[model samples]
Target: YRVGKAPVPPRTSVPFDPAIFDATSSTFYSALSNVDFRIGAGNAGAVAVRFRVAQHGYLRHVDFHIGSGLAGVYQAGNEFENLRFFGGRYGIMSEKTSPAWQFTLIDSEFQGQRNAAIREHEVDLTLVNVAIRDTPVGIEIDRGYSDSLWGKDVRFENVSRAGVIVSAENSVFTQIGFDNAVASNTPTFVRFRDSGKTVAGAGPRYRVSDFSYGLKLAGLGTIGDYATDIQMAPLARMPARRTPAIRAMPPVRDWANAHDLGVKGDDTTDDTAALQRAIDTHRVLYLPVGRYRVTDTIKLRPDSVLISLHPSLTHLYLPDETPAYMGVGGPKALLQSAKGGNAVVSGLGLWTGGVNPRATALLWKAGEASMVNDVKIQGGGGTLLTKGSPIGFGDPRARFDGQHPSIWVTDGGGGTFAAIWSPNTLASAGFHVSNTKTPGHVYELSAEHHYRAEIVLDNVENWEFLAPQTEQEVRDGVDAIST
Candidate 1:
């Protein structure tokens, strides 16, 4: 052992190939989930201490050694969901060098952190439905002004220190919910303690109860003279499940062209029967570049993977006709995937041949790791979806004799929707999550231009809507406000 100074150990580098991993296409990959990583026993130079998660990507559904003990992130856009961190020195620490803005965390839990659950600096954060248990400090935010700490359903129980520790780093708090948190000895929401890193920002704005309930409710400790907001109820009210219902890896079957399978992509033929037959028998729907017309609905097989040569090359044209509102599921969607379906529809184009405002472009009922990506849509109802469903246009649920949304989530099996653009859609709500008993997670959501409310939450207790980018609020709709 050295007596004068401690010697630094050598750093090992892990190998990663972008072409092999292909992380840019989120829907094509599933290998990152359900992985477990363990390092040596707790030591200063343990393998876990030297390891760090890749900067600006997803740490989803994997249990790492020290709970993604990430530091020195190179860029932004990193996401974490459904990950559990235990027995780690700290869950995730953003030091002075980390410049990632608005790192999103959803449906994750942290326990047995040696010091704190999170040690943040200079980064704005969005934490939804996250639980922190048995931690000294749940979260220690160093800066306050430019950094906004927005969270919903964030619970803290069996904590040693406060749920969050701050140094007046000047981070602003718009949506703060610590009314349900109990931590350390005092059980405070935000403890104005010293984290040693001071930041300069604005005078932080806060909104707790909107002229309804009084501030400083009983059992909830004081936030500080500068504190004044409360949070929504029931964040961790349910369990988060990440199991894919169809329990099979993305198939590696040989591609089969739809035109070769007795189905023509010509603009006039009613290819509904032929396409449905193809979707039922085949595992992959690799259509060539052409417009395939269909009069009736197409039922997608549970394990089918419908991918196209290119979105511009392949198209599904549904003609406007009499209402085919089948009460069995909801609407006879142009493309329907039933319960427990692990369908994958990607790189295609959908167009309602006529002004058929009665049916959705796609009704994805089975969201168990199912995905619909890179599909351009025009006209018709937008979409009626669960956790992992996508959208096109219009509200198919309106003609079903009930108010329906472009995004409807009823299942609790939790999934994700990314790069979703719903510019033109006729629906009661742009986003709706209801009729579920378990907590769900949907991150990187961007939707707009729908009727009624842009955001709607009813009967659903805890759903993590992380990094939502919503715009184009309608006149009658309340964007981002749950009613």
Candidate 2:
């Protein structure tokens, strides 16, 4: 009998299976009705019926249909839809009819407690699974792992190398002792102690940079009120060698006259041939105190040193109408050997016309080296000119065009220029030391030429111009002096 909100009539019945049907079925049409239902038997025999209700007011899994007399007599399809199960359990029993069966219930609620206990149980199980999955295990240290002490005393070992060790050796300053030394009375091989303030010893100190160059070793260490002791180191033994002091060669006299190489003092004519003769004989040429005029250019050969007998006051004159007094081949003239190095033109008053600025009173070639001292060069109240074409000025056609007087001195290689006295009313560079490829040369304003190559210009000065001035004024002043 089924009993619920949808109650069935008393005699009404329907075939039922506890496993397949529940009390929620509309077996009873009214709440006030009661009905009896029967479940058919299976193949073996009749089975006892069972009904179980859920807390959520629904019928749970229950077994009823088993071996019975009505086996295979009643058949029901498994497919069902829109079945409600919430409440007390209801049972029905009926006999099979016409090999088929139909349900009678429309809608009914089972009588039981309604709660969400099953959902809560599922959530608890999920939490337990998460806890088990999240538990930590072990850790690993990779090759890239680094700690604060990575670069310290400890280091990774490389076994394949020849001189590699797992542990480091002790430092050189480590303590050492005898094998039989007592454990509590170890003795050190070397003794080291810091000196107190009262004790006498040296310490580090700082110095100012401004006085660094003037500072001396004796001034480095000093005691407060007491003097510091300096211990000098022993000198090492060494081989000795003789060294001599160099002295200047004395002046030679009558050396040129003996060789028939001498210039007349009173002769005002251009003595180019005599000068060339003296130069060819490689003798000391002498131009005694006189105003000897030179018309053409005079070139000096190697191994020939020209010397003037007179001192600074004597005068050697060059006519204002003539061309340059002296012109040595630019780079062609060179001092061949150190012994052959001697040329002296001294005690001469040189005069040049300002109109011919390209004319040089004295020109030295690349290999030629000479010294002019204690001589006066006066430009004839005009610009003294100097110019040299390819034939005269080495391989390159060089032109020197300026009002400023130029005395070109060149060593076949290159040399230096030293100015003794700065020109007045104009400034003139002293000497131009040439590079190896070039030669050294010197350009003087108006000056006397004296002394040998060694110690030349040792004590030479120009009376007319004694101060340094600008280049323009130097050119103009040189021109005025030459004129």
lDDT of 1 at 310: 49
Can you tell me which runs of candidate 2 are displaced by over 4 Å? 1-250, 257-262, 309-317, 323-349, 353-355, 366-375, 380-405, 410-483
Model 2 Cα lDDT, one tens digit per residue, 165-252: 1111122211111111011011111111212111111111111111001112445475222222222121132112111111111256
Residue 453 lDDT, candidate 1, scale 0-100? 51
The clash numbers for all candidates, in the given order, read 18, 84
Candidate 1, residues 160-198: lDDT per residue as tens digits? Answer: 556666655333342333322322222444655544422
Candidate 2: worst 10 consecutive residues by lDDT?
A: 123-132
Worst 10 residues of 1 by lDDT: 205-214
